[model samples]
Target: MRELLVLLLLLPGPAVAEEAPPAERRTELLYLLRQDCGSCHGMTLAGGLGPALLPEALSDRTVEGLAEVIRAGIPGTPMPPWGFEITGEEARWLARKLKEGIPP
Candidate 1:
């Protein structure tokens, strides 16, 4: 019974979904998006030095893919990695928000 329980504990379980960031953190993230990302993606997120971040522009991309880009950034480009400032879960949330189209 002890061995069986140990085996069960060692086995992989179902994937756990990450919870959304708290309201205050979400607000701060949004502000970072507007200020930092906006510097390249455009204040309206339409387009600028970087491509547009609007929903339509992101429609073909997967949330995970976008999140990876957000976390890792494109190398050899002006884009800089943001992994230091945000967690992977937060990156996913931002990716989802971009896909949904942020409200004006």
Candidate 2:
């Protein structure tokens, strides 16, 4: 009974925090990932101090390739790996959002 009460109380926080739509959530995550990860990869993902991430530029690459980039940034560049900042799943999610392009 006590355990059930705790679970009930805790569920709302997680649920409320997930208010964004799946795509929106992914977009926000991508923005954050870009900001955190892009600190080195260029704020616009256009390869400033780092490599570019333009969709047309990466159109030929597989999502896995993109995920790898997110997981482990390009070597010999200012970009450092982010394998630990977020999980593979999160990386993939970001990749999908990038592929979709930031919605209007």
Candidate 3:
């Protein structure tokens, strides 16, 4: 029983919310957003081949849903999975930023 208890204690706990990426990484991520994502979403994210990422445009979407889309991408669409390039937490942060409306 004690061994089992110790094993349980040693097991990894459920994921906690991750801290925002470091400022340097944040800068890189934003650059990627503007240069890479922007190529498809529009330089201003005002909707081009991809839909607008403005707060109002994403008002109906949940952060988790947006994160999933960012990581997984939409099948049959031009969007490609970015999971290989960015971490899930980073994606979530980007999703939140998009929902809040990133500055121009």
Candidate 4:
């Protein structure tokens, strides 16, 4: 899985974002992350069908890059892009939070 991330990082992509979601929206977004992203990334984010999203695992990855991946997804992989459901800004926020190992 780590190897996949390394390969993904080698690919080129776009990036950007705005302010994080508000309290209510934040809760919804967090639920989306847990239920949607968590489906593949694992509820604990340790690893599963998708790569581990834990902070230590994602240490080498930048927030922008991960955000791009979420927005556009890695080509030729099971990881589908979430552009339809999540905005670039939300994706960026998600990436940043994932980097910090997610809130408890």
lDDT of 1 at 42: 98
> Best by lDDT, which number?
1
How close to the true structure is residue 63 of candidate 2, measured as C-alpha lDDT? 71
Between 3 and 4, whose TM-score is larger?
A: 3
Top TM-score prediction, candidate number: 1
Q: For each candidate, what TM-score against the reference?
A: 0.81, 0.62, 0.81, 0.77
Model 4 regions more than 4 Å off: 1-18
Candidate 3, which segments miss by more than 4 Å at Cα?
Answer: 1-18
- The C-alpha lDDT values of all candidates are 0.82, 0.61, 0.80, 0.76
Candidate 3 TM-score over all chains jointly: 0.81
Per-residue lDDT tens digits for candidate 2, residues 1-99, read: 334333433443323443233544544565575667567656767766666666766778777788898789779876677787656777775665566
Kindly report which residue stretches of model 2 are placed more than 4 angstroms away from their true locations once superposed.
1-28
**Can you write out model 3's per-residue Cα lDDT over 1-104, one digit (the tens) per residue?**
33433443344433224456765676778778888999999998998899988899999999889999999999999998999989988998888778877657
Rank all candidate structures by their TM-score, best first, as comma-separated numbers. Answer: 1, 3, 4, 2
Tens-digit lDDT track of model 1 for 18-56: 466765677778888888999999998998999999999
The positional error of residue 51 in candidate 2, measured at the CA in angstroms, is 2.3
Cα deviation at 97, candidate 2, in Å, is 1.4
Worst 10 residues of 2 by lDDT: 12-21
